[model samples]
Target: MTLAKAAAEVRERAWVPYSRFKVGAAIRAASGKVYAGCNVENVAYPEGTCAEAGAIAAMCAGGDYKIAEVYVIADSPEPVPCCGGCRQKIAEFAGPDVRVTMATTDGKEKTVTVAELLPGVFSAAHMDRA
Candidate 1:
């Protein structure tokens, strides 16, 4: 299945109660495996897990460290972009050229690279700066 379709399918399982906003994410690892996850919210709010984070976790669990592409789907008036933390998470597992696709349930969508979403992202190289 397409990444967008995978995300949309997983969205049905999101555990959002407070906001009632469900989100889903799918990531294609460099190994060509597709992992999917749905937002899992907790009553404590701050402890909630974003779909992107969950997907990344699954990828790591499956022994893949590089993300080649990602797709996220949400029910909204417009394509919903990843949260700031998720953008950084994506950057951590993906290269600057990795494509990130944001989409609404009704098919509206936008695609951009990880670099475009988080320009000049913090990397290990920054720690080497003198």
Candidate 2:
């Protein structure tokens, strides 16, 4: 199954009682394994887990530190790109050229690279230079 489809499928499992906005994410690890996650919102607000973050955590738990590609899906009029935190997280696990696919539940889709999502990302390389 495609990454977008995987994201959409997992979206059904999201725990979003407040905003009722469900989001899903899928990441392809360098090890060729696909990890998927859904947003889990909490009542406290601002303490919810993003779908992309959850997916990355799963990838890490699976022992994969590199992301080959990513897909995010949400039920909106346009494709929903990752938030700022997720954009940075993507840059952490993927190279600048890694493809990030953003999609709407109704089939609208857009593709951008990690660098496009977050230009001049603060990565470990920059830290190493310090």
**Tens digit of per-residue lDDT, candidate 2, span 89-113:** 8898999999999999888999999
Q: List model 1 lDDT by residue over 86-120, tens digit each.
A: 99999999999999999999989999999999998
TM-score of each: 0.97, 0.96
lDDT of 2 at 86: 92
In model 1, how many backbone clashes occur?
Answer: 0
Per-residue lDDT value at 92 in model 2:
88
Q: Highest lDDT among the candidates is held by which one?
A: 1
